[model samples]
Target chain A: AVAAPAIAQSAPTIKWRLASSFPKSLDTIFAAAEVVAQHVKAATGGKFDIQIFAAGELVPGLGVLDAVKDGTVECCHTAGYYFIGKDPTFAFDAAIPFGLNSRQQNAWLWEGGGMELLRDFFKDYNIHNIPCGNTGTQMGGWYRKELKTLADLKGLKMRIGGLGGPVLARLGVVPQQIAAGDIYPALEKGTIDAVEWVGPYDDEKLGFNKVAKYYYYPGFWEGSAQLSLYINQKKFQELPKEYQQILEDACAYAHLEMQARYDIKNVNALRRLAAAGTQLRAFSKEVMSAANKEAFAMYDEYSAKNPKWKKIYEPWKKFRDDELLWFGVAEKSFDDFVHSTRGGKR
Target chain B: AVAAPAIAQSAPTIKWRLASSFPKSLDTIFAAAEVVAQHVKAATGGKFDIQIFAAGELVPGLGVLDAVKDGTVECCHTAGYYFIGKDPTFAFDAAIPFGLNSRQQNAWLWEGGGMELLRDFFKDYNIHNIPCGNTGTQMGGWYRKELKTLADLKGLKMRIGGLGGPVLARLGVVPQQIAAGDIYPALEKGTIDAVEWVGPYDDEKLGFNKVAKYYYYPGFWEGSAQLSLYINQKKFQELPKEYQQILEDACAYAHLEMQARYDIKNVNALRRLAAAGTQLRAFSKEVMSAANKEAFAMYDEYSAKNPKWKKIYEPWKKFRDDELLWFGVAEKSFDDFVHSTRGGKR
Candidate 1:
């Protein structure tokens, strides 16, 4: 009897380049791209490989999406909200002022159909997107002087990212979208009154505490900032089934790792910042309330005019409302009590 | 000058019970206490309270030490590595095998560390102790059945837990000490042939993929697993801290949540054993050979020299190391590759 023909299994090899909007100095953010490249190479047994380039390497930082959409590069790591100038609805893909926290974002994306909604949005730009990481709730910003009331925000110029700029502008504040490298000099030169980067870990490294005496809590603009990996839609579809799954799995692993690293690192940095006399303060009640009002108003205006924003915003807002109600009754009450008590010290 | 009279800030009140050990479900091994009292009541603006438990409820499942030691709780949620039976170091803390797997000895325990670890090993058991969970890691669990060479296992079974089990049992396989909940129950069971478990996320939940087939991973000697809540040395001191941090934190959060729940859920739960029939097998030639040799050799040598182990092992060894490490890199490489490939399949 003739032996059954042996099965042949071999995968095609492919190479691509990835550009990131972030600088290498921020390890967690920059590492997401590295993780994707590493996993894909290992899974395909060297059959497929991707090279990564940090911000400004092949294109200007904010120009990443344009480059990818135009086929200048194969993929890019970025926060979709950065391109809100093109379409305000893009902010929902990353974060919005006073929006969902990290866990909520994950729930919405993976289970609440947010991914599908966002993917549909991305088709316009010709990219296939996958969430790769999240920076949990972030600290407000750093200021040269303590913000005591609403009056303090008048004409205050600060460097901020995403749609937060416009919301703050409504509150009589001027917002600037400065790159990471340029932030330190601007703050040192007093060209800006304040700035909001990430939390303590990144802030400490940036030496913001030394330049800005008042560090505020609750970065209303980005309760939880989500990061995404944008692959050329056509290029992503070309990969074998297994290679694609590996990419997704790697992204999930990196997502968890980034959060864990930030949680641990932020605690130590916060303690250090406090010891350095960084003057931690809560955002003034007036400032907080005003900002919230303006944020919702802006959202309402966007929904009335932007069909894309309206489609996702309605369901997204409802989900957030329901989740808040449930957490308010249990998580909040428990956290408030334990955190307020001396016995709850971590 | 008049001294300003000191004013006390009233403490906030709150109540909560956390169930954990192995994230969520996986009962007996991690969810024992909820089986006790799920309702928790608190007064003083919801200040004082008492309720059910879970691993990491009051203390990290691994840190039942400081939690019980510092009066953070009146009880705890935990397993023995969890204290190491506290110093051959605390082997009797859980189970010993050629040891126990679930049924063999609810007979040995409830009668063993069930008493000994709490009495001799845990002299300060002023707190109540109980048998809350157990999973007999299936004997010589999960393996890749096509071992044509003994060298295949020069270092295998890399996913054991605790210091004693992994270190002592290094024959032809490398012993890995992972947490109970994470073992899979390792990649559907066959991912790593010969894993030890509290029993089923062991053989069942993790359904060794139809790929590997050999269901020889569970190390049987783990007959019965034991968990405990070590109370504070001092505040088991005060009649009440108000059921406050003590009773509220312990009984409500840790003590009763680990094992019993795991048992209830894991029973006869192997219906999905493998959509594809699984080949149940045993450890083979040269493979089992090298393990027995290395396990005992390491034990005897360590006992002869280390006073710590000598003090604990005289009685701890029957269940101590007799395992082996095989010489192969397939498990690690395969795992890394497979995980990376998961999301790619979409």
Candidate 2:
């Protein structure tokens, strides 16, 4: 259980550069990368330290994977969905339309076959993956107008997270792919009808509620958006076993902490949003039903055309379906009763 | 920032023993200490190694806190509620009747001032606590007879987690705190009428389904039972900053992972139990309501007598009540729709 004495005596320090898809302005999301860094440094007694780079500083936001794969940097913190255009299966690593929620996703990655399957896929790109952060189920979006019925989704013209865009499009919604910084201006100037960024914490900061009066949930598309750390395979393997595990444990800390912050922050931010006249809403059953059908249909199409997608989709569908049943019975049942009573207490 | 290189050059290794309240037979629960040890040693280059002693090896399972406080062991991995006889406030650290569920509990600790409040309380015992593991909402328990109404609970003999005992007692339950190993045989031989262990995973191992046909859920007392790593205060403070943070992060890793494993394992185990003719059931609405009512009343009683309980209880109730409202609207609404449709798909 011990390494060579000489290994400690030399005390060589390794410095790494970490690329993050999120800009520094989104502190809660971006801060997760720093959490990993701080914890790793503290664990290793400063023998290792990582410097974080914001989007476009060292590389463009979505280019994190490419940078890590090519060894441009030792690693990058990013959402896997950003690379979905390369292979739609990539979205499963982050979040997909109607995919598992945060608790279920963690179970999948840590226990069920998820980590093994995803690692096999990541191996092809010469990279390793660790869950680094999570933004809990997102808001549907901030809408300029209330979506009263199914027809409201027609030509919705909204900026959305990747995989859901296609699913939404099939339902007659005109989904827009806009840059993050430009979404506010686009919404403010009436170029788009709505936008979904994240949940209340980030949304409040983005001033989405100020411009758009109607706020909706659940984000149907992204149940639990997980951010990952992509490490170059060679560099990861070269680390001492303890250092490697420390990196992973550190990422796990950031992952759980990020979600905790959002869960806690969103409650008060949401209350503030409501007090400020932001109309909180839920998508109509009609809209939700149509979108659900489209999402599963798209999954079917991908399964038929792509063997890699087929391999993951078949099992993922089973995990998701089973989780839904179990959670529906206990989690949902308890929440329903407790929530109603909470209303009475208030 | 770097620690003294001379500190590393000395190659000094500090070995500490971790006492686990669980027996080796309960590997899933007992193994968390090993997980912490393996990770910590790796992070520190094997300079700090923790050897875990299962329950009864050094001291009795429930004596973990006392052992650590008296310096018999440097630390322990045990559930906080096990020490409730000493201070009822201890129940809040693990879980409480009608308390926060796993997600909310996590949010409370990492963000909602729970860690600070609990730490302040732990100070009186001259102990430091780090949340090390969690068992997600447990099975209400294994029942020999179906509970059809609140009246059925009169004089019911059941083995339950701590705080819930008082609540159940108020509603006519003869609460028996049985040893974990003795529970299976106690139920098998008709000594206890019902027993609530953890959920399906651990329950299956204990073979509860073989003897008790009816299985129930949403263990009202422990929505999430958090296992903590309790360190003697002086010893904890003596550690280097790097070592201190490593211990905390390692505990965090184990804490989140324990729940993930339970969430994943329970699904499969529940399936197996069902296949083996286990009569899966939900506690009747009447029973849940009485238990809920009694739980609150008990909390009020504790709040009146215990200063620590009162200080924490005031803020916790507000946090719990508010979270229920928010989760009810979004989380429950989404699950309700999605779960209903999953039935047809299967």
Candidate 3:
């Protein structure tokens, strides 16, 4: 009889399925999942393949975490903060209001002891997260009219999500959490005054710029909303060490590629949006100031009440603070001077 | 007879050597090469083992490019810009004076068609480049006394490298290319007034702070110095596709990890240096402004004289310009507001 173990070892073929919390139409955001899949297959010589299922095909879009947790799918590509209701600590893995940008977040997670803290926390949920994608800082929601002050935010009905919604609610705006597929129709019918999806690339695809002519800068909420490949802990541990390493590097490739894709596509989209008569706007000092203050207070409240939040927040806060200081010294100063000379918005 | 092709395919073990352009003592920088080697070996089940040689162990630190080109080593983990003396076009592969930051460089390479341009240029050297590492924005230098204006740079002796040294030469500063081992001694004996190595992490190791009390911000000339894994074209092509990919993914992993390591380590190092009476200083606006003007004019002159430089700089300039504008819009605004509240240096 042929030795079963030897045959399996020689030509090991493993198939994995990933459930995404996004539809296929949002190419830049959802294509990141496929980036991981393609890189995996290419790197492994077709020995390891990750078949991707768009939202609702295998599980509901927002149901990715549950699917992986329940072992329905081996993995998922999703924004971890989507499950903030389950555990507020999930926000750290993605983005929180007034949190780090793409570069800052990567520095924290990869260098600032973030991954280990997150790994231990995730272990409780039977998940292993590999950063797979990031939408560079998102655009603030499109507005029906240009808002000049914090007072303008009061009673403004908008479609926003996660921690941002709660923060905006404190500013007296009504934050409506709408499904992606339904946002445009709701906005067009005046059911909501505005909506925040992603940056220029994804938002342009959704045609939000068409209805809401005033496009804003800095989502401020999700400064680089990170998406991750969450693998079921049991399933991931069962793979050969080679496959595990290969899968991880593939995720790293996708993670870097996603930001690149967004940076280029968003630049072009913003240009096109401006040409198409979308007025670019900045959040006023008053609005941003109030939001920032409210956001920090909320974090403190969570730290006091939620044990998980308290445990992670202690370190997370320090990391974020230090990161801001460092970026101010180097990255920000150079960027500011360059921009001022080039006639950019100050 | 046994089937030769099948037997060859079943166990394809390949061992290679890498020449690193850094000493082993600088773990953060040098270990990036080892990261690629380790990840590749782990991903390939030790089928591809890459032995690493520190600077001067196999070839001199600055000899990595030649070693790969001449097939003395299969590859090198070195800063591409080190070969700028041979061709100014080489600067595009790494960082140039006042060039793109780490995130923007990654965007340009991965998305804005930078890799293709670099690959076309590298063809002349018979090498292929995989962006494998980065030292995020560096410190300007450690100065014996604080620099207040453009006048302060006149006849200042400093140990600097790459395009930065030449750019500084246009200013009143006299650039000194001291060996790393001798930099401390030179600084101690007042032979050199200042030294620019990497950031706090590496600078502290070299003990620049011991003699130089004033440490500066924003090594403006090198916003982000990227290091590449330069592979011999023939050797790369000869490998089975899977090994090639495993190596590529591993390099990407190192690329991501290197910056992460620097960001975190530099933070701690800076803290230590500050505590030890190292006065952190920002280059005055007048100084940064004058340097920026000089750098761009030099680029223009190079574009006129060098055909290779002209070919790449056109697109590179456009990409850099666009990147600056975009960052100004979002990333800078958020960072500026936060830093203002947190008391950042002007």
Candidate 4:
């Protein structure tokens, strides 16, 4: 018995199972987990192996956080905001309406004291969180009809992700929760008037364009959605420090790779969708303005009542504001000019 | 006999030297190399160790690339663009005048076929490149006086980086390549009219504010500067696969960390500089517009002359144009709104 522990200290063999809140068909999101697993295994010369299980294999997709918290699996890949029902504070780990974008989120988590705050918050759930990937600002969704004004949203039934639903509901839209497999059919048969998925790459995969002709710009409810790896705290603590560090760097590699995959794939997919006669539309200023107001009001209400929400929200808000101001300066000016130069012509 | 290679495959101790182009004083930039070294060592259970030598200890800052190319050191950390004197194509590996921003560059390199192109290009120099870090969009420079129009740029002597100088020279500016330590004295003594380092964090550390009254926004010359680790190709090929993957992941980890460090540190430093009476100014429309035109023209000239530059530039330009269009839609709208909501009061 003692020899096993001693041998492990040198070159121990360990196996871990990773549950993912996505199906294998959504390769970019699902492959991020595989990226982490492959790098970890390759870096350790196959001493450490992590097997990935897509959603519904080990537990339901929405059940990942609880599964990790209970040590049902060693870890899980998921969007933290999916568990907002348990506590709204979960959104801080993922995305909040009008919050930081993908790059800014990376800055906050890696350097601006976010990881420490999040790590402390996560302690209560017996989970150690590591960022895995981000879906840059998302498309609003696919709609059956055009959105012309704030009134156009009233009573419109749409299938959307969890955290964003409540915000839309406040604008008189009936936000429906539909399974990933069912979203396409729901939109096709007019069971739902609209559906919001990841973006051009994933949305095209789901054939949302086939069912709904109007594809909207900017999923305002989620400026940027971050995905995370939730490791069981006790299991993570018991690893050799070297293995722990290896696992972390592996996640960082996957985190970078996932966004890269999306950026390239989405570019190609958007072109195809456009050629196939998909109508791209922007949300009216009236709608975006109203929704932004409602979203902030909701956050204020939560801050007034929830201590945990207030603690993270205060600093997170400050970081977001500062980043916005800074980015608005150089980054915006350069990008605006370049973008305005259509076709790369001077 | 030949046990060294055999033992190295199974935890044999191996040590290598890393020459960093930056001194230890610039903690964020220099610390990126340390992050890579520390992570690799811990991941390999201390079996693989890398010792870092600051600039001038092993080689001059600008000499690190040639040092790696000639196997003087196992590897070195430096900006690829620093060697543009050898070939302008080196700028693609780092930054070009009005090139892709930090996030866009990451997307292009990791997913948009950029790494392959650059890797092939580096093979000619007996080097294998790994991206190490990035300084997001930089501030233009610390200006002794405000820029009123395009005419003011004529005959202005400014200390700038290597790659951006050519484009500026075409705009009637006399570009000077001054050593980092001497930049402050040169600016203070009125030998140079302006100086562009990194951003506020690094600029403030060098005390640019005391000498230059007016600071400027949007360093158009180098929209984003990327740093890389250049490994001696033959030495890199000799490493075990496990060690190789460990090294790659470590570089990515440091790459992400460096940008995050800059983002947070720059924000705080900008605030401090403003309170201390530093005046932040933007490059006038006339200056930015004229510079933009000349920059693209210079790129066209290089494309017509250098086959290597044309090979990478064509695809890179397309990817850049597509990225600009996409970012302009959702990201720009959301950020513009939130940033305009000054003081987070809205």
Candidate 5:
């Protein structure tokens, strides 16, 4: 037995193609996929290589999931909710109306049994999902007119995306799922009354503040809009375990990196936006309350029809309730007192 | 009318002391203060300078808020929940058990009326708060014994911190709020049966996994643990508006950078931990359910007694509920399927 020497096995080289749903112009979101590619190549010493394509370069911006599912692309960087038209459940993989904020979403995905559930769902689509990045609770949108009440939503044509679009539609919003590139034009030309983008940094770069004066807060539809890496199931399985681990690590890195970029850039952009006379407004109580009601009603209807929704919803809801109860006392009280005070300057 | 040529006023040179809750050994959290200092100096061309002190250098690690409030330090870099003993509400500012994960916290703080509410809270403490960094949903902790059921938690003495310590205590586990430096010693000496530090990256550095064989998942309490920059309000007002804006931008930059470091570092450390025979375990359902019940009862009792808690809890709870209802349908459905499928390899 000692006479036989074990041969060291080298990992097989893997080449992957990642098509991003976002345009190259949107650096933070698009760069997330690039970050993953760079990390994978470096971590594996180039044993694994991923070629990334911007939206419309390889396929339509919204066609990424399907492209990955059909093996047209090995992977994709996209918002899971974008494919809600195919199955409403897809929204959890990305962003949902009044869903978990970025942190909560990350918690749900990474820790709160969310990752397992999502992986199972993606199996049906022949894809595996990893949260790549998140736009921390987005702004409501860039509005031509300030929304003062729930009535402001009625008949309003807005450029939005994912499950939120349909939820908004319930509030009498004429939801238009426009590509990123098309949004500015739509708002500029008055084709849409409003547009909800990531936040101030992206909004400033897009020059939406110039076209729309009123920028609303609490992107309730997307408390945290997560961007995901969807890989073809077969392609994922073919890779060596180390390569698989590297991809996962890279995606996680990209996930945090994207948020950091947004946080840093948003502050400066917000100052600039404010300087440029962008009117920042919180969503009116009437509007937020109405949207909240519609959002819940929609969920009840979906859960009744969708067993998948019900299965996870039960546990998830219970966890969320418990979380809220604790936060209400400890988290809320301290924040209230400290945030209200005025003191000496640094 | 041409405004009379106004003389450009030179900005005042300012120096500040920042007391950090974390030791320098934890580079990511500790480095946030340094990053903010660097950014402020660079942005203001060194006219504004900040000196950062690690835990116990200026004051005890946990006394940062008081130091900032009493003007002992010009600023502090610490989690809000560290001071929850003063008021449970502080947990919301930092992290609450089962609260908003990192992204959701950011949403609440930055967009969802959280900042305003928190700022109101901070006013009492004489601090101006800006989020400096975030640890996206943290790990449950490192344990000496495998947690297979609720029984494992009973009588377990764990070195944990923040709001989680109390929630864990309610689960029949003895929770010890130990400082970062003391965690290793406590675990090694049998003074604590287990320790829940950050994720594997920090855990490996601290060598906790070396002693604790069982590593758990889903830190229910700290979905997203936030590190904040608490500035002396009076000192903040003294800075020029441009400098103030620069400081805010710097905090935002650090916030993103810290998370990036953690996300990249955690996986490798996790792999190393696994290789080193650290058993990974999920918190048992019974334990989780029991903790949830205790967490809620604690909150209801506190809400009834604490006015500050009641005021904010009402809104925060409502918002969280509404958010969950919407996410339950689309997000939960997709995640349940995807996560259960294939270890989310894709």
Candidate 6:
């Protein structure tokens, strides 16, 4: 048997409660919190434990940011955009329309000085944000009718999330902020003309295909939606340095896991959706082009109006542009070729 | 102040030595080992410490696999394809010519059953593998002269890494294997007509642009190269469960960190290279198509002769195809649109 070292004798036991903005039914997104908790607990020899509470268990889904900010829970898992009403800057922590994709988002936050900039911004809100998950590129919502042109989007009642609502609102879309559970019924009853939850896996679970015949490609608002862990600043500061490092590392682990889970799961889910006759349609270039123009205009206007948004937006935009140039050279050419010439007969 | 828990008293202290296949000057790749070590130490309050040794400090760079396998070192960070001379099957652990890109590779290993298959294979070598880093799709290589057609490759002497050599050999190219530090001198002196050494950041450090102005794109050979931590299975199983979990999570943290570092760093390096008059060229569609055909034929030949290769290649191929289909839809469409309409004039 091995002897316990002197260092272990000084390690403290602590417990934390994590509130998740997602329902347990959305396993891919919700599982990120579980992954963090599992790794943190296992690494700490159970000395540190985090109990998870699904949406509405501790607070309503949309209330998680405030719950974490006020220390109602020690931490919470949420998309930054969910709290955009508080400050449009929150969208940068998750995603904005026509922003970075999953890998590029990760590159921006982790290496392109985005974290440092955002950490400074988050100080005002009394929270610390760490990326915990990402839904690759989401499918555009299920449309009750095919949207073949920019004109088709006019007056469409869509249950969109976060800043996407405002961007869509520019294009004559009547954006409704319905809770996840309510989306199915709203779409079925024609109360909402369109809905986009996540990708194929999560959407299939919610049965959106049963109501909407046309499923779209590329949710422009969320080229990739990143989810974050928001820690109560005071509560986080109280933890031992070791525990703090463990928490950050655990979140990184979850971030990679969540993306991997979505990538593979979405592949099979999409194939199944296709087999069952879900009509997959790409947003026409006319719609995509117009949306692209509006998204940047929105960002430009925010830059002029909001100093906090401007601080992060300037660097973030440069990083995105640089990334696009580099990826265009090798990554795009390679992927386009390999994907076009898929290896299997299947 | 909080009191120490009884659980802390039972935690054991441990130390490990890590061998890296990269020189310290290659910070992005070498930093992965440091990232793992730093987190493991900080999270354990220095109770569990890991010391990193750069290439040749513990053993030669190419000898890391053997060092870890024989228990000469507790673990080592290196690319699996480096040992293909022992068995071509090792390529799956890193990259095969025209294989999955970085994200797809992570998805395959972590979620698409590739890890389980690889674990079973590694058991025979008495090692446990954990992904530590990935260099996203690499540049083809730097050439002294531009090659426009398949005929230009005939009898050309080039220094390439791992399985890429054999693939290139089929096109009448004579492949040279040279260490990273030696590649520049060889290219400068015209000892080799070309050399493919990673992407822009690392290549810039080597000053390849000064010697070879013709830099090619879409390294069809290494679409993405994954680096792994290979630990002695006996050493891993002997650790306390908590330490094992900590070590695994640390590798995952490093895995994400390394990729992000590359994604950001490469962007600036490429811009610098372009400004310095580095000629960026794409492999002709004719060349890309022929190389691609040869690559699949080679894989088919291996499957016909090698049972181990057959077992893994079949499933891996299917997963690759499914991924290609899924990515081609939304990811390709979104990225194509965004890149074509870059936000900045710069």
DockQ scores for all predicted structures:
0.02, 0.54, 0.47, 0.48, 0.03, 0.55
User: What stretches of model 2 exceed 4 Å from their correct place?
Assistant: A5-7, A344-346, B1-7, B344-346
- What lDDT score is found at residue B310 in candidate 6? 97
Off by over 4 Å in 6: A1-7, A343-346, B1-7, B343-346
Instruction: Score candidate 2 by lDDT.
Output: 0.84
Question: Per-residue alpha-carbon lDDT of model 1 for A1-346, expressed as tens digits?
Answer: 2211111132456788999998899887888788767655653445557899999999987999999898899899999888999998888888998777665676677656688999998999999998877776677889998888898888999999888899999988999878787898899899998999988878898998888898887787887788998888988887755456556655654565465456545655777888899886667657766887898899999999999999999998876664453333222322222222223232
For lDDT, the strongest prediction is 6
Q: In terms of DockQ, which candidate is strongest?
A: 6
The lDDT of each candidate is 0.58, 0.84, 0.85, 0.86, 0.72, 0.89
lDDT for position A138 in model 3: 84
What TM-score would every model get versus the actual structure?
Answer: 0.53, 0.96, 0.96, 0.96, 0.55, 0.97
lDDT per residue for candidate 4 within A253-309, as digits (tens), equals 999999888887887788899889899888877887788898889998999999998
Task: Write model 6 residue lDDT over B1-346, tens digit each, in one string.
Answer: 3223433767666789999999999999999999998888877777787889999998999999999999999999999999899889999998998899999998998889999999999988899999999999999999999998999999889999878899889999999988887898899899999998899999999999999999999898889999999999999998887778888888888998898999989988999999999999999998888889899999999999999999999999999888888887777788978977865333
RMSD of 2: 1.9
Q: DockQ of candidate 4?
A: 0.48
Alpha carbon lDDT of residue A73, candidate 6? 93
lDDT of 3: 0.85
Model 3 bad stretches (over 4 Å): A1-8, B1-11
Model 5 TM-score on a 0 to 1 scale: 0.55
What DockQ does candidate 2 score? Answer: 0.54
Backbone clash total, candidate 2: 0
For candidate 3, the TM-score is 0.96
Residues B1-346, candidate 5, lDDT per residue (tens digit)?
2211111134456789999988898987898899888766654445567989989999988888998999888899999888888998887787777666565566566545778888898899999998888876677888877877787788999888887888888777898877777789888888999988777778789899778888777677776788999999988887665456557756765776676566545645666777888886666656666776777778888899998887777777765553343233223332232222223231
lDDT of 2 by residue, A77-194 (tens): 9999999889998988999988888888988888778999999989988999998888878889999999998888888899997799999999888888888899999999999999
User: How far is B188's C-alpha from truth in model 6 (Å)?
Assistant: 2.1
